[model samples]
Target: MHFIHTNKSFLLISALIMAGLILQACGASPETTPQETPLAVQTELAGTEVSIVTHSFPASAISAQEARLSTIVMGTITMLDVNEGDRVSRGQVIARINDNQIRAQLMQIQAAKMQAAAGYELAAAAFRRITNLYEQESATRHELDEATAGYNMAKAQLEMLEASEQEVQEMLAYTVIRAPFEGVVSRKFMRAGDLAAPGQPVVTLSSPGLLKIRAHLPENLIRELTAGETIRYSVPAAGIEMDSVPLTRVNSSGDQMSRQFSAEAVLPDAHESGIRPGMFATLHLSISDEPAIFVPQSALVHRGQLTGLYAVTESGQAVLRWVRTGRAHEGRVEIVSGLRSGERYISVLDTPVRQGQRVSL
Candidate 1:
């Protein structure tokens, strides 16, 4: 019994020593304060103010006077003087058809006319001589009559030949094609040796003096547009924009398929702006004058499919707030939703931030 009690006491003392060692090791271990490093960041307050509410619609630049030049004669093209993009003057010869056959026919008619003229001259001389002989009773009446008939026939033939030559001359003139107005050739449909039929377009010409924007707007929006309303035109691809262009006209009829109405705006300073036809443009329409929230573009962060900004909470914690964005202007973007005016956002940060991360302004 004494041995068993001694063993129990030793076991109890060993257990106490192990517990004391465990406590000492735990006390000596490093402790974490659960603190996060503060991030240096720049913050901005979202703004809301009455601004122009404009809607952009696709459009294209067009000339006031555009034409397609066509051929008037059916023949093979012999000479093409001007190509696409060539500047031409009024009545300038731009193309010519093969006139060899017409020229040859004209020469033949002229030769025939000369022959007829000589025959008529001889016939007239013989008729006069025969009439004189008959009056003198030296020639028979039948002979004089026959000579008069021959003279009349020769004169008729000569007149017919002259008419034929005139017809040929007119045809020769038709072989040459000339520009009807002074403009730049926009396109060419035919080249040398190509067959050009009557009424077939050879080239397209556009006058650059007057320019306009052609756009199609929804039927509901057309009612708000007026003839002289001021608007804006922009070409995103060309990096150009013009303000205060007056609306020229609007079509009353709506397209059955597109449900859109066509509209036109004349550019008063097109020449000074160096605008050309066929360039794609955008037309901006002022729809309303309501206040909207706007934020700097640098504040936006895209994650997965969510577009949002890094906002600062009341406790100075960074929170990712998803937002709906509208059109962008300059360096600022319109915030449609999820972000309110007067709220602060981290516009710039030294290091990347996370949700619930502490940030210092």
Candidate 2:
């Protein structure tokens, strides 16, 4: 017709210019000044007072005499002479054993004790010449009883080879191992050709000159423990701290399947506190302070296994709180429950926020 009515008026003016650019992009309005600016963060006002109320537990650092050492015979180690931390003392030999078959059976029992002291010195010179010829009557009472039975069988074969050369010199001093005290050789377990036997061990020692923490405590905190009181230990994995520590052993039996109670403590300068033995420690104890909550471990917030903190709410927003931590002192962290002290939280984040995220001061 007129070219199909002028192409249907150019398709109705390109569909009204795409609906007026979709209503001018739906009345435009999204620039939100950098997400409504607010994320400033870094707070902390979780108060609550009355401090002390301690009660820690989980201790360890023992060694009020460790030991181990072993080897009472059954040779072949041949001179190891102390090593693993070596300190040794009480007779300090430390290791030896291969005494060439106890020095060749102590040189064949000292050559049979020098042939039984030359046959007991020729049987005491023929029993003093047959008792001086039977007091001058010229011997023979059967030759003075056959020279007194050959001088009492050569003086009982030289006293049974001098008691078999003093039991082969005490089995050659059990091939020397020594050190039954002074300690510090934490552990060696045979090395110089290693063969050792009789009870195995070979070295472990310890004795940080009397240290001790040991803990277990729970028969309701062993009735507030005593033995000399003092308390407050800590080992934060060996950074060790002591402060009064004293409680020395409180065991009156209780562990019938861990009702607990096996205390210890005693750190009297733990031999200059190099600590030692097992290690872990904690202790503390005090008890009646109350009002807890604290916080600040950078306001926590771990999520995947929950341990939280972004809390800010009251409309400032942030909110992630899940809390429930305790006893981290100094850098703060006791919260013990879903947080409630003063409440603001969100300690110092510098960016990654989210849950209702708004944050500011």
Q: Which candidate number maximizes TM-score?
A: 1
Could you give candidate 1's per-residue lDDT for residues 39-134 as a string of tens digits?
Answer: 889999888856666788999988888888776668999888787778899999988999888899999999999999999999999999999999
What's the lDDT for candidate 2? 0.78
Model 2 C-alpha lDDT per residue in residues 210-303, reported as the tens digit of each score: 8787888788767767688677887765566656666877999888996887888667776575667787878778865567777667768786
What is the TM-score of each predicted model, taking all chains together? 0.50, 0.32
Off by over 4 Å in 2: 1-60, 68-96, 121-125, 139-164, 171-173, 176-186, 194-202, 205-211, 214-246, 249-276, 282-361
Local distance difference test, candidate 1: 0.87
TM-score of candidate 1 versus the correct structure, residues matched by position: 0.50
